[model samples]
Target: MPATADFKFTASIDDSLSGSSCWSAPSNIALVKYWGKKENQIPANPSISFTLNQCKTITGIDFQPKKNTGQFSFDFLFEGQPKESFHPKIESFFQRIFPYCPYLSHFHFSIDSQNTFPHSSGIASSASGMAALSVNLMDLERQSNPSMSEEYFWQKASFLARLGSGSACRSLKGQVVVWGEHATIQGSTDLYGVEFPDEIHSNFNHYQDTILLVDKGEKQVSSTVGHDLMHNHPYATRRFEQAHDNLKAMQNVLTTGDLEQFIQLTESEALTLHAMMMTSMPYFILMKPNTLEIINKIWSFRRETKIPLCFTLDAGANVHVLYPENDKAAVLQFIQSELVGYCQKEQYICDEIGNGALKIQR
Candidate 1:
């Protein structure tokens, strides 16, 4: 098969993409949309995410023939502890995609990854881990089969990452990643997300995302359960349509470079996502009193200071503040005060919009 867009490097996977030296990939923050997924956990729509400068994961994978069953003999160590879920999840990921790389049955993979920042602190650490694993495995496959396209290799790697965590798929692409409607996303048999169309992606990278860890505590609605709630909700379609509309509006503004329109639409989308969570028939909510208070404070502060600041949140209560480059310092100060007043066990974190997956070679 011919190489896909990203996989094609104008040359075969020779000494460059080969070898098991130390490898790493960066964290990502979402810009557009990626609220749903299908089979291999691909996104329902083409969403974009920025690779971050601050947080990253360094991983080293060494493949070996084990003395065990077809299942990989796994050893995982990161953050100075053994990640208990790593082994089982990796096995499960292999079980689901056995057709693509049946050799997984014979090889044992020793993997280690650690973040430059706190783990599971609403910093999108999964994004970095997933992207790193995807690229590392793909590079391995390329060492064996030099004819693969970068796109196909990434897609396959993404499929595997999805089995570990859904958001990991977004981490496979660098600078900005677009998780589109492939089988995993569009309810088909194939895995990994489809890339966005050229027409839609042409102007996508200009928009930026800056995250603020408002609460930094744990999350109430994890991505997996949160997605399930969306499915079970009686007004699912209505909310989905609302998200769709919001995504479209945001995309239009992104293409036009309209900052005002972008902020308004993104703020609305963040609220709408939470609103959907609130109104689910049985009723579930991810926000706490502090969450709401922080939001209100942000709005109040913006109103009082007349600053061009706007805040948005992902699955967790941590708020991501979005503003132009000129206002970054002021926004950071605002977040610091809000944390001092509202949150009990939270730290103020700020990161500008980042790029997609990257291979940090040894």
Candidate 2:
């Protein structure tokens, strides 16, 4: 684990520094969900996820020296439109990271962000958005300290991103990323996400994730509120233990290409995540009736056809249908025929495993 002191910027920065950075960071779907937090945005349990391709956020930041250095300053924009509603979250994020990136107070930032998927829906938009913003911040930091290594650059970026959104750490790099510490996984830590250190079987390469949008509206209970409920949750301890066990099991399944075990663990984790939510104090259900309907249809289709298809949810009504690249044609056809009707506006997104964030050259 990296000490927080390591991230503190101690060197004097020139007041004339002015530049910009843009990054496109992909959202991730957790096979082992992270439901709760401890302090400073640390996860209560270890979780691993697949970095997605099409579902992402593009963010750019322009920064220049400002006269006042007492407080942070930034202009926020979403899809080219000024959005004051987003200021609170960004303001909170800046406050959290200001200690580590203290140079922020000396500059005014123009932040423009846009997402490929719905903003508040359960598509992990926060993950991608924060990841992009963190990398852009890192880009500015690199201008001050050009000798920073590539390894340290991404590690610190993931660290900073986690402070913004826990899962955002995982969106920084790799097709598979693991966050939170597990005894068996080397280099895992609660501070940030790490690329899966072991070799992955070719059978798992380019895995398909077709997301079925059951609801596009904002969630009734924010993830922050849901995470807080776990503070006094009766099942929190057991759920945390279960996540560790399942993540261990998932590691083996990925290496051996055991699709059956993969399906079992993935689907179980999805349901268990919602179970935690439903069983929490003032319990709530993020899954709609159609969410369940889609799961059932996918199960039936897999049972009849013996395909390795399965489903997972992300704290919302949308369902992510997973399968191997070889079975894409069949699974997509089944999705179109049986599941599209259940989706709101028959909307869905076709995405696959990706190599994480990319820097856009100006």
Candidate 3:
């Protein structure tokens, strides 16, 4: 079911000429990965993710009505410097979502965005960045009409975020979020994601993600290219079926806090996501030598200590080590003593399931 709450507009931009909004949104690590996508950024299969804390993007947008009759224009900055590469993607996002915010084309947008973690380094930066932008757009809507319901506000933000980046919809809120329509989950739709309503044990609430950056370079194959390759993938049908089964099983695991099943399913999903890439029409491999080494060590460590520590990977070479809060000390000791060697310059980010996006005043 859609969430309902009051939206307190504590601050707003100047109403006469211009308005501005700022938001900080966290990136998410998918347990049931969203690999292939359809037209309009729809997911090929349902996926669930944990919204992470430390890794996030802060975005602020200043909007002003156009002085002349012309197409929408905007300037983008990443950490206060011109980012020409981001303009086309943002332009495409605006073009795709023009209907939802028709007034957008009539205004000029000044967007400034910055990330807490490295871009294209295995973490879902696009998810955080786009979701933050989506929230700001929603705030703009609220500025014009204060009567918008809270449920209506977030749903529209989630919907718009999905258009910018498919996985972004899941970055909205709740520790766990589900994207894509499912027969078993009610109120779940392809247009937007909804929170997982089942009982999540307290033990899993403080789950930590210790990321090991095996390679800091850009991915060999972009996620956009990889998603398109799925159209001609040999195992496309079976892959989708596997994802559906995994999602259903994960729901049970989450509710019961079955760490054993959680490790099995999550590891398999991570490997399967990369497997699809290797089998694509123009096959490509993203994992480096250290990436595999880290995975093997994680397995060995789990067997030696029986600490319930496991690993998963995003689209890049970085590895995300997931474990419960109860084992925080042991896990940190393990990472410092063992896993840190695999990371480039010993670089890694410690994160946890976060509370989604935040509105920044100013």
Ten contiguous residues minimizing lDDT sum, candidate 3? 3-12
Model 1 over residues 95-192: C-alpha lDDT tens digits? Answer: 65555555555566778788877776666676677667767877777776777766667677776676667667666654545554332223222244
Give candidate 1 misplaced runs (Cα > 4 Å).
1-19, 42-46, 67-69, 182-210, 338-340, 344-346
List runs of model 3 lying over 4 Å from the truth: 1-17, 119-122
Best by lDDT: 2
Instruction: Give the C-alpha miss distance for residue 121 in model 3, angstroms.
Output: 3.9
Whose TM-score is higher: candidate 2's or candidate 3's? 2
Instruction: For each candidate in the order shown, give its overall lDDT on alpha carbons.
Output: 0.61, 0.92, 0.87
Superposed by TM-score, candidate 2 places the C-alpha of residue 98 at a distance from the truth, in angstroms, of: 0.4
Model 2: how far residue 253 lies from native, Å: 0.9
For each candidate in turn, the TM-score is: 0.81, 0.98, 0.94
Clashes of each: 13, 0, 0
- Best-matching candidate per TM-score: 2
Q: Can you write out model 3's per-residue Cα lDDT over 1-362, one digit (the tens) per residue?
A: 44222222333334355778899998999999989999889889999999898899999999887765357789999999999999999999988777677667667889999999976566668899889999998888787768887877788888889989988998888789999887777678888888897879776987999999889887888999999999989999999999999999999999999999999999999999999999999999999999999999999999999999888888889999999998999999989998889999898888888879899998
